[model samples]
Each structure stands twice: as structure tokens, then as C-alpha cells.
Target: MLQMGIIGYGYWGPNLVRNFNVAAGSQVSMVCDMNKQSLSKAKKAYPQVRFTSDVNELINDPEVNAVAIATPVFTHHELAKKALLAGKSVFVEKPFTHTVEEAEELIELAEKKKLKIMVDHTFLYTGAVRKIKQLIDDNVLGSIYYFDSVRVNLGLFQHDVNVVWDLAPHDIAIMDYLINDKPQAVVATGSGHFDRGLEDIAYLTFYYPNNIIAHINVNWLSPVKVRTTLIGGQKKMLVWNDLEPDEIIKVYDKGVKVTTTEGKYNLLVNYRSGDMWAPRIQATEALRLIAEEFVHYVEEGGKVVNDGAAGLKVVKMLVASSKSLKNKGEMIYL
Candidate 1:
């Protein structure tokens, strides 16, 4: 069994403990947090697991074989480096680190140590996303034309990172996973309403090779919450609404075709409209699968889709977006 030590018993820590403790190849051995009240709450729920206020105690524990970092983005590099140096695998939260350099350093160190690093891109494991991946791979959505996403909600503004760092990661990671082509450049624009210097709303556009484009809009000041994505293709189109209870994915058999006429400058346009169908999605919790995959890969050396390299790609896009945001929506090459 792979013994697990979790850092940061704040918002996301308890969920990690619950999933890893019950995972097939892992068990939660200890949890570390700076907040005494958090430790007190965790103690009641997990009496068998050890609790500590000092983070080093958990990283240095001989019984722990891996560490799951549920802390903030700024602290990821330090905590993950300590665990990797101590010869333990690491599972990090999304937006991997505050900067691309930090992510690269941790990835190189983990590679040198032969330790596994899995980023918590929980959405990738969801049934909806998995199904969508299948559709794209099977040529159901032939030759993707564009990817557009909108994720917005009011009032959950973060203190450390802006809305792009906080909300755009999920959509960006999803777009990165679905599209095989790498983006050539990116443009972003946003503004901050508060004194924290963190933008509350942002718009990002990524230019991909072969005419594929991706646009993402994220906000923390919307009147209503929306999680929706549209993928347009030559043969068909898809709509994914994450908030839907039963039907999360709807594939439409629709397309537009252009043909040349007899005249030199004449042209014809044809729009084909057909039926729409919703694929059946498995109801398994994505977090549970993520926990299981981390443990299995650490124990058996299996391949993981959301590995350190995947995290780095998402970070690279984020870095480009930040640069563009600072220069008033200037295009930054990747």
C-alpha cells in the first residue's frame, strides 16, 4: 500500500483525505495544516490518521510514500520539491505553480528522482470529458474548427491570483486535452475592480495551427453562474453544459459547405441540419478516479494523462495569457 500524507487541510484537503484513504493502493497516514482549527476538525473525522501543524513532519515521515498538495498555488513548488527530495511521489492541485519556472524545476527534479507527479485536473476524469475525447478521437467531430468556453460566477474572488489564474485553468486544460494541435500564440484582456491588483474578469484567445481557434471568458462578477463550452467542426458540432443533471453532452449533426459555381466569381453555400443526440455519461465521481489513478500510477508505473508535462503545458498558456494581459491584449507567441 502507498502511504499518503496530505498537506493543507483547508478547503480541498478534506476531499483528498477522504478519497485517498479509501483508494485501493493508498491510505492517508497523516495530515498537516497551519490552522489549529482545521487540524481539530480533521482529528474528529480521521482519528486513525496523524495530524501535525509542522509541514516538514509530514514530508519527512518515513511511513508516507507520497504527498498530496492541496495548498495554494504559490506554495506548490516548495512543498512538492520537499516531497520529491524526500523520495515520495507528488499529487498537486491545479494551476500547478505560480510560475512556469517553478513548475519546470519541480518537474525536472521529479524526473531526476524517478518519482511520479500528477496534477489534479479533476475535470479531465469526468464522464462528460472522457466521452467528448472519444468523440473527437473517433472522427465524430471531424476537423475541429473552434473551441469556445464560458465560465463565470459571482463572489468567490481569490486574494492571491486573478480570475484567469483561478477560473481559466479548468477551461484551458480542457481545451488543451481535447485539441491535439498546439497553440501558436495567445491574446488576453482583463481588469481588476478591487485594490488587490488581481483581475476579476478576463478574455483569452489562443491561435492554433491549421486554422483552429480557442476563446475563453472567465469572470468573478457575473450575475449568474455558467459552465458551458461549444466545439464547432466541419462535420458536426457539440455543446457541453456541465450543470446539466442528465444530459451533459449534446452532439448535433450540422455543418456548412461551400461550393464553386460555373461563373468565375460565383459561389454557393449549403447548410446541413440534422438530428441531435446526447451520449450516455457514467455517473462516477471524477475526484475518486483521480485519487485512484494517482495511487495506481505510483504503485504500478502506469501512464497518467494529467502528468507533470500536461500541467506544464497549461502553465505555459497561462503565462502567455498573463503577458498579453499586461500589454493590453498584445499577442504573445508560445
Candidate 2:
């Protein structure tokens, strides 16, 4: 069994601990957190696991073969780098690192150490996303035309990062997975209502090759929570409503056909609309899947779906988007 050490017991930490503890071939050997209250709560819940206040203790623990980091974005690089250099595999939370340079360095370090680095891109492991990937791979959607998403909610505003950094990572990671084409450029616009100078609401647009395009709208000021994505393709279209309890994904056999008439000036347009079907998606916790994958990567050498390379791609998009946001929606190349 692979012994695991976890850092941070706040927010997403508990979920990671629970999943890794239950995952096959893995066990939570130790947990570290600076907050005494968090440590006390963790100790109470998991009596078998060791708890410590100093991060170095957990990183250097002889029993720990890997370190899972659930701290804020800024701390990811240092923590992961130290864990990797300590001869332990690293699993870090989403938005891998604050910048692309940091992610690149960690990736290089992990490679040199012959260790695995799994990025906690939980959404990519979701059943819905998995099904979508299958459909796309099967050519059921034909050629993708556009990807649009809206993720917004009230409160839960982060002090360390803006709405784009807080919310856009999910969609950006999803886009990077579903669409194979690389983004050529990005443009973003947003504003901050408070004095923090961080944008609470943002709009981001990405241009890809083959005339493909994607747009993401994220906000922390919305009155109601909304999680929706629309993917349009030449053969069919899809709508995913994450808020729905059932039938979250709907695929429509709909498209438009254009033909040129005998005369160059004349044109014919036709709209084809057909049935809409919802495929059943397996109900499984994404974090659990991620934890299992981490174990598999550690025990058996294989490529993980959301590895350091994938995380680096997402971080590059985040960095480019931030630059565009600062430049008043000026387009920035990736």
C-alpha cells in the first residue's frame, strides 16, 4: 500500500483525505495543518492518522510515499517542489500553480525524480465529462464549432483570487480535455465591485484553430447559482446543466445546412431539427475517481488523464486570461 501525507485541512482538504483513505492501494498516514482547530477536527475524525502542525514533518515522514496538497494556489509550487525533491510523488489541488513558469518547474522536477504529479482537476473525472469525451472521441458530435459556459454564484468570494481564477479553471480544464485544438489567443473583460482590485465578474473568450471558439462567463455576484455549458458542433449540439438532479446532459440532433444555388448570387439555407436524447451517466464521486487514478499511477506506470502537463496547459490559459483582463480585453496570444 502507498502511504499518503496530506497538507491543509480546510475547504477541499477533508474531501481529499476521505477519498484517498478509502481508495484502494492507498492510506492516509499523516495530515498537517497550521490551524489548531482544523487539526483537532481531523484528529477527531481520523484517530488512526497522525496529525502535525509543521508541514516539514509530514513531508519528511518516512512512512509517506506521496504528498497531496490542498492549500491555496500560491503555496502549490513550493509545497509540491519540496515534496518531489523529498522523493515523494505529488498530488496538488486545481489551478496547479499561480503561473505557468511555476507549473513548468514542478513538472520538470517530477520528471527528473521519476515521480508522478497528479493535478486535482476533479471535474475531468466526473461521469458527465467522461461521457462527453467518449462521444467526442466517437465522432458523434462531428466537428466542434463552439463551446460556451456560464458558472456563477453568490458569496463564496475568494480573497486570494478573482472570479476567473476561482471559477474559470473548471471550464478551462474541461475545454482543454474535450477539445483537442490549442487556443491561439485569449481576450477577457471584468470588473471588481469591492476594493480588492480582483475581478468578481469576468468574461473570457478563446480563439482556436479551424474557426473554433470558446467563451466563459464567471461571476461571484450572481443572485443565483448557475452551472451550464453549451457545445455546438456541425452534426449535433449538447447542453449540460450541472444544477439539474437528473438528465443533466442533453444531446440534440440539430444543425443548419447551406448550399449554393445555380446562380452565384442565390443561396439555399436549410435547418434540420431532430430528437433530443439524454444519455445516462454513471453516478460516482469525481474526487474518488481522482484518488484511485493517483494510486494507479504510483503503483503501475501509466499516463494519468490530469497529469502535470495537463495542469500546465490550464495554468497557461489562466495566466493569459489574467493578462487580458488587466489590459481591458486586449487579445493575448497563448
Candidate 3:
């Protein structure tokens, strides 16, 4: 059995603990947090699990076989490194680390120690995203032309990272997974409205091979929350509205075809619009799937979709976007 040790009991930490504790072949051995009040609250729900204020105590516990870090973005590298050095497999939250160098170091250390490193990119395990991946892989969407996403909400702002770093990682990871092509360059623009130096809103564009392009808009000052993505392809199009309770994915038979004429100036542009359909999505919680996968991979060797290398890929995009954002939308080549 894989004994799971979780650090942090705030916000996302509880979800992690709940999932890992119930996952097959794994159980919550301990939970560590600096806030004693948070620990007290968590302890009530998990009377069988141990709680600690000292993170080192949990890391050094011989009963713990794996560690999950749900702390702040800045603290990820240090905590994850310590966990890896302790000879335990590590599962960390998204935006893996503050920088690419830190992510690389952690990945290398995990590899050397022969430990698994899973990044908690929860969306990848969702039924909606899984269906989308199936469509793309089956060529149901044909050749993808462009990917555009918008994730906006009010409040829930962070002090450590800007809107791009905070929100863009989700869509970037999705786009990276769906689109097999690697990005060639990136450009970003954003501004800060409050006393905090972090940007409240940002726009990023990624140029990929074969004329494929991706754009993401992330904001923390929107009047209404929006979670939507549009993918245009040669044979069809898709719209994903995450807020919709019943139907999250809608695939449409729509596209534009160009016909060349005898003359250079003579050209015909045809638009095709057809039926739309929504595929059924499994209602299982994504975190539960993540927990199960982590335990399975740790006990039996196998490939992990959201491994440390995948997290590093997302971090590379974030770093490039940050550089472009700082340079006033200057394109940065990846």
C-alpha cells in the first residue's frame, strides 16, 4: 500500500487528501500545515489520519511512501525537492514551479532516484477533456487550425503570480495535450490594476507548426465568470463550455473551403454548416482519477500522462509568455 502524505490543508489540499485517502492501494498517512486552525478542521473529518505543523516530520515519516504538495506556487520547488530527496514519489499542483530551471532540477532528481513525479493537472483526467482527446485522435475534428480559450473570473487573485501564470496554465496544458505540434514562438500582453505587481489580465498567443495558432485570455477582473474554448478545424468545429451542467462539449460540422479558379484573382470561398452533437461525459470526479493513477503508477511501473516532463512543457510556455509580457508583447521563440 502507498502511504500518502499531504502538505497544505487550504483550498485544494482538502480535495487532494479526500481523493488520495479513498484511492485504492493508497491511504492518507499524514497531513501537514502551518495553520493550526486548518489542521484542527481537517482532523475532525479524518480522525484516523495524523496531522502535523512541521512539514519535516511528515517527510521523514517511514510510513509515508509518497508526498503531495499543494502549497503556493513559489514554495513548490523547495517542498517538492525535499520530498524527492527523501526518496518519495512526488505529486504537485499545476504551474509546477516558479521557473523552468527549478522544474528541470526536480525532474532530474526524481529520475535519478527512480521516483515518479505526477503533476496534478486535473482537467486532463476529466470526462469532457478525455472525450475531446478521443475526437482529435480519431480525426473527428480533422486537422486543427486554431485554438482559442477564455478563462475569466472576479476575485480569487494571487499575490505570487500574474493572471497569465495563474490561469493560462490550464488551457496551455490542454492545448499542448490535444495539439501534437510544438509551439515555435509566443507573444503576450497584460497590465496590473492593483497595488500588487501581478497583472490582473493578460492575453497570450502561441504559434505552432503547420500554421496552427493558439490564443488564451486570462483575467481576474471580469464581471462574470467564463470558462469556454473554441477549436476550429478543417472538417468540423467544437465549443466547450465548462459551466454548463448538462452538456460541456458540443461538436459542430462546420468549416470553410477555398477553391482556386483559372484566374489569379478568381477564388471561391465556401462555408459548410451541418449538424451538431454532444457526446456523453462520465460524471466521475477528476481528482479521484488522478489519485488512482498516481497509486497505480507507483505500485506498478507505467507511463503517466501528466508526469514531470509534461509539467515542464507547460512551465516552458509560462516562462516564454512571462518574458514576452515583460517585453511589451515581443515574440519569444521557444
Q: Is candidate 1 or candidate 3 better by TM-score?
A: 3
Model 3 residue 134 lDDT score: 96
Return the clash pairs for model 3, or none: none
Between the candidate structures 1 and 3, which one is better when assessed by lDDT? 1
TM-score of every prediction relative to native? 0.98, 0.98, 0.99
Candidate 2 achieves a global lDDT of 0.94
Writing each residue's lDDT as its tens digit, candidate 3 over 197-257 gives 7899999999999999999999999999999999999888999999999989999999999
lDDT of 2 by residue, 1-334 (tens): 9999999999999999999999988999999999999999999999999999999999999999999999999999999999999999999999999999999999999889899999999999999999999989998989999999999999698989999988999999999999988999999999999899999999999999999999999999999999999999999999999998999999999999889978867889899899999999999999988999999998897987799999999999999999999999999999
| Root mean square deviation (Cα) for candidate 2 | 0.9
- Which ranges in model 1 have alpha carbons more than 4 Å from their true place? 262-264
Local accuracy of candidate 1 as per-residue lDDT tens digits, 1-334: 8899999999899999999999788899999999999999999999999999999999999999999999989999999999999999999999898889999999999989999999999999999999999999999999999999999999698888899999998999999999998999999999999888889999999999999999999999999999999999998999999999988999999999999889857888899999999999999989999999998898888688899999999999999999999999999999
Off by over 4 Å in 2: 262-265
Residue 89 miss distance in model 3 (angstroms): 0.3
What range of 10 consecutive residues in model 3 has the weakest lDDT sum?
257-266
